[model samples]
Target chain A: MAPQDDNVDAVEEAMVAEVEKKPIATIVIIIAMQTEALPLVNKFQLIEDHDSVFPKGVPWVRYHGTYKDLFINIIWPGKDAVLGVDSVGTVSASLVTYASIQALQPDLIINAGTAGGFKAKGANIGDVVMVSDVAFHDRRIPIPVFDQYGIGARRTFSTPKLVKELDLKVGKLSTGDSLDMSPQDEAAINANDATVKDMEGAAVAYVADLLSVPAIFIKAVTDIVDGDKPTAEEFLQNLVAVTAALDQAVTKAVDFISGKCLSEL
Target chain B: MAPQDDNVDAVEEAMVAEVEKKPIATIVIIIAMQTEALPLVNKFQLIEDHDSVFPKGVPWVRYHGTYKDLFINIIWPGKDAVLGVDSVGTVSASLVTYASIQALQPDLIINAGTAGGFKAKGANIGDVVMVSDVAFHDRRIPIPVFDQYGIGARRTFSTPKLVKELDLKVGKLSTGDSLDMSPQDEAAINANDATVKDMEGAAVAYVADLLSVPAIFIKAVTDIVDGDKPTAEEFLQNLVAVTAALDQAVTKAVDFISGKCLSEL
Candidate 1:
């Protein structure tokens, strides 16, 4: 064989070795809303599990299936049985995340949801941001050290290679239970240096960190929190499009994460 | 036997039967702060658990011991390791409550803590409130049905017997992450018709309801949210005294719960 043929064979062997080494087998994607979860579920061909996958009588829903080399599960805090509204706050998110971790024991956690972005931070509707850090914008316990504790700032697992490979925009995320921002929340969000805000990212980060599992936040902007448009109307108008954008981003991220080591991401 | 002797024997037999009926064997008391927990821990003579009762490296502390006929466990979301501050929000409260339920499978859960009361609601300093209803004051999602969903209101386990026996003050409680109330939170609180506001009661109620565990709220007044004094200064000044009040109330509640069934409470 020619020297060129030998070089080509060596490159092919390295690529095969990388593909064969499966470091991350199982992944749990925790989405707070059914609208945010359905597209991914369809894309992955996940089956809805109703028979005690989660504790019965609870609104938490789980869908599971295999995608490439990854065993993927999507966990959504289902609609409140009485009120018939999506349970979309940090309380539901944290419990669902903790329960998912306990049940699935996933190698990694992905918190995917729609968020409100800041116009000043150059965020537009339909932009998908890979969050680098997360902090609470409304947990204002103003006592000396406890004030810091209330913020509960946490860093998501670093994904430098994934960010570079996918060419994704990166931002810090702030979380609070309120869908609309208050003055105090704005100040706290500013202090966090956040470009996007949501109700569940920081909470999921807290639980994932507590369990020693690596977590990444993927948020698509549904509204501009500081812009001229009313937040409720804006969010409602753009949710479908933003969710579609989020679905695409998550799909690409999962493809990149499949069969890769934590260090590689 | 004489007729008087026969009547005395019948009364004694009834007393023995009541004592033997141990309906509620295990009870879990979830307190948010160390200050709130230490007093109850001493009162119940609970031994601190440092082993795998909770997961390793997590700051949640469990104290377990038997008090009368009830196996009592007090779970405190311990101080944050980095910030050295008590974890006092709904996130921590919900997680610790869920974990305790999963580990101990308690027959009843008591969320004992300090809260801000309303003077207009006939609340005074050191008053311990047995919350009848719980709702969120800060989860302000402004959409139509979601606006109500954001409140996440739920009635706590009915404690008519406990209330009648202990003569505890009953109030509707509202929860938020912030120690200080914002205007939005105030409006939500008013809508819920809340008389007391805390950081964790409604969250615990949500978890307890989800798990089908009976839960009661016992909160001592630490500060008045609508009072003239600043919230942070007031909370710091009264935390110790209020915690003592909480300890007494929880002790009495536990005593009442010891040998009783859920229907009795």
Candidate 2:
């Protein structure tokens, strides 16, 4: 595992994508980050960095970058809770934004970032957790099985075969944004039985379900979501420890993505 | 069946939907020609007319109009493929857009329109059939079990529960603007085991799945997809008997929608 290198910047510089064959593989990865997504990988290798593969800042809409064998591009939509390019009509805009970055047409998307852990007996600090099922914990509609939010009598979340194939630890994930983090938040969080919490994972997961693409959402438990009373600063302060887990997780993810792509071949 | 005061202006007056809170239930009717839509049955009505809705020519968009207890919308995505809006995304936009207009949240969305039937021994000119399954046949990658597009395998499709509940004659409908009008197209259409073809049904189904709302798409067969060897206009003209069938099919759909809504309440 190496650190972010000065020469690695050059390695990123040389990466070029040919439109002749947009890498629409059977497998793809979509990594979402609450803070910085770099540290999760124990081995940080520079695969390819391009001038404009994806999107950039507030004014600039796209940034194109790739790492390891993964043709990675980042679009910071800057929206607080869920941020993906807002598209017109009924299309998956995030997936579209992802597809428009033509270096790799990914079949799977991995949403990796940090989350506030539930701090239950089963979950602990710095544990890398996998969201086995993702859903809007707050959504309540009483259908036949009485499913509401992520807690349903029948089934509350979306769990695909990919989750089983990866052999990752499954935890319930909150799909909606934390608009109001009140005292009763834990009571609601406890109901879903999640290992951690974050905003972007579920949004990405929802799109992946529609695309029928395999998605792996990795969240390093940052703050104990239940300990004391959780706040934004408390979550941000623990960013480094979480990033350390991100480094190894990301490395494993890169390997996983490469294997997935090669398997389809 | 009586007309809605026939011999009056053919094109509708406004595009914005009229409210339908708890309206009387009615049968679905398909008047092939727009002029005949409202005139076929005094009970038969036009939900939305494209000419009047997007009078300014809003391409790649559909407008939904709801009448009390009954909901209707008009959709025409530029008559071909190479779209400005992705199908699923735009349908969500239409659902949300028209939902606001309707004021009355609909129990379900019944898409009423005409479609082309895939050539088969049993299927013939003007056969009135209900879509058993709707899929984007054009969007597929070869897999082990079969060729799937997105749902589970490369040959993914969306089937409405209502189709089976009502016991409507099953028909296959394919989405995407690339109408396979050539004789060579038979092999591929048969690959999915579909009997009918259309452009927007799957998109609507996907959105309905996402919102967890029930949706029924009723398409009247207007032409046949032999292959690209034949032009679209050439094939549509071949189906002369479909005229009356189209009207009957549409009428059934509307009635089915009405019954489904009232029964739920």
| TM-score versus the correct structure, for each prediction | 0.91, 0.40
Candidate 1 falls in which docking quality class?
acceptable
Residue A258, model 1: Cα distance from true site in angstroms: 1.3
B1-265 per-residue lDDT for model 2 (tens digits): 1235543333322211222233434322211223223333334443444344322212323334444455454333332122222222222233332322233334455555556665562555566566656665433222222223222112212334545554556766655423332222344456556777654566565544443344555666666555343534644465345545665665555654553433332
lDDT (10s digit) by residue, model 2, range A11-111: 65453223112343433334444244333321343333436443232111233334545555433332211122221111333433233323344545556
Where is model 1 chain B poorest over a 10-residue stretch in terms of lDDT? B13-22
DockQ of 2: 0.03
DockQ for all candidate structures vs. native: 0.35, 0.03
lDDT of 1 by residue, A124-202 (tens): 9999899999999999887888888889888899999999987888999999988998898999999999999999999
RMSD of 2: 20.6
So what's the TM-score on candidate 2? 0.40
Best-performing candidate as measured by TM-score: 1
Q: Can you write out model 1's per-residue Cα lDDT over B1-265, one digit (the tens) per residue?
A: 1124878779977864564354989989998988889888888899998575777657898999989998999998988867778888999999998888889988889999899999989888899999999999888888988988888889998989999998899999999998998888888888889889999999999988888787999999989888899989988899998888788888888888877877778
